[model samples]
Target: MALGGNPIFNGKSFRGATQAPRVPSYPQSQPGYGQPQYGQQQYGQPQYGEPAWSTQQMSSDQLQQMYKMYNRPSAGPAETGRMTFDDVIVKTAACLAVLLIGAAISLFVAPGTSSLLMVVGALGGFVLAMVNTFKKQPSPALILGYAGLEGLFLGGLTRFLDALYPGVGLQAVIGTLAVFGVTLALFKSGKVRATPKAMRFFMIAMLGYLVFAVINMVMVWTGVVNSPFGLGTSVHIFGIPLGVFIGLLAIGLAAFSLVMDFTSIEQGVLQGAPERYSWTAAFGLTVTLVWLYVEIIRLLAILRGDD
Candidate 1:
């Protein structure tokens, strides 16, 4: 299934306002004398071995004014505070910590209860996720809320899967981490990028996947399929469950989306974008990780069920 909750752009463009430059210090015809000229030597010959004044010693106000005038942060990618790919990684890890804590609580509180934690986590997480995604500006409150919701879902899912297949939760955790780590390394190594062709393929494949998911959900609700997995159980390739193959394809697509996220963050940092967008980077990453985890967990479940 496709990961839900992508941030929506309301089609608003950020317009930077331009103010008129400060008037020239003096008319072109006038001599420069208003500002202190310490570097000036007397019209007569200088006394032997006297030191010269340095611009490095300007007062803080003078330096700030100079920066405002000439070094104004460029409108393009070179804006200040834009988050780097490295920053996203660190933030994502921190968010994951919060998620793990929530999961731990669910596991301990209501062990082996499917609807209890999973429903709470899924519905709660989905609500908070919407709040965070559609928010005009990011808030720590909403982001943390999303994290907690995801944790509950993960914990319940882990407990359920682990009960069926001992240590499966641990395996899934390790697998998720390994995938994220390797994908990041490959992205940083410059061997992978979100090329035009790839993105187009991803969009089309994602659309097809979404349609299948909606149809499956309808089938389940209509009692057309007794299995919880719907069409995945009915369809098979050479005796292999269709869900397994579809899950693999979905995982591949999610992994490539991570690559695109990495590329976008890289461009933002190198262009010097405003630092506030780090939250956007964090959000994108969280979305991908959740998708990855869900895919892995579901794939494991399908394989286990195959037996």
Candidate 2:
């Protein structure tokens, strides 16, 4: 989303959409512009065979007409490397396909093997994510590769969690879809937006959330809190688990992130961003969806943890 430091949309020159040079108007070569029009009489056309033309005899209107004759038609958006809604949809589908393939592979593996896959997928996905994110030009292979790796991670993690919290995976899937649908509707209706003020607030909240996440991780690792879910489990507010509040907040943040993703994609399409960057748009949306799904599932799991 347009939240504080989303590097994907914030990078220079490599961002989703960029300003393109105006289409050019091609003029005749005018090879001998300075000299009298080649092969023409000193005064003007000879009024005989091969009626010659000279630069001196040329009028502004005539020059303009001649130039217009050579001028080329403007390039269409596809030719200009501009983004389109179709490009986003197509590329997103490809990424999702690859993701599902990876996830399928992880799903049926032995429990022991699934655990190993989870670790490998998580680490490998993180590495690939960074590589794809910072590249100046969009790479279909890398973007799809990231999707596949993340699918492995998601599948393994989901399998592990689902074992403990039965039906959480399905619930999360429904929740993710519901949120996506509602958010898209709101965005299309112009009810929800990534306005400057809203984005500022998003960024601040995201930063605070990141800080808390890091501290909580440290606390768990250092045995400061023995809860499996870190401080989210140890702390309670108003008789509910902190994670419920945090998870709800996180879900809200992720929901807004989808808006940012939509904004970026819409901007790219409207700006006629390079067609290749459609992959970028697709990747951005996938990341947001995955984040949203994970948050939703985790929240559900946490709510059912004590049960």
Model 2 regions lying over 4 Å from their true place: 1-5, 12-76
Best lDDT goes to which candidate? 2
- For model 1, state the Cα shift of residue 103 in Å: 0.7
Model 1: what TM-score? 0.74
Cα lDDT tens digits for candidate 2, 1-307? 2232356765624344465568989888775755667666567536556646676789999999989888968877777677788888999999999988888778899988888887888888888888878887788988888898888888998998999999998999899999999999999999998888888999899999999999999999999999988988888888799989999999999999888888887766665567777888888888888889989998999999955
**What TM-score, over all chains together, does every model reach?**
0.74, 0.81
Q: For each candidate, what is the lDDT?
A: 0.73, 0.83
Candidate 2, poorest ten consecutive residues by summed lDDT = 1-10
What lDDT does candidate 2 reach at residue 81?
A: 70
lDDT value for model 2: 0.83
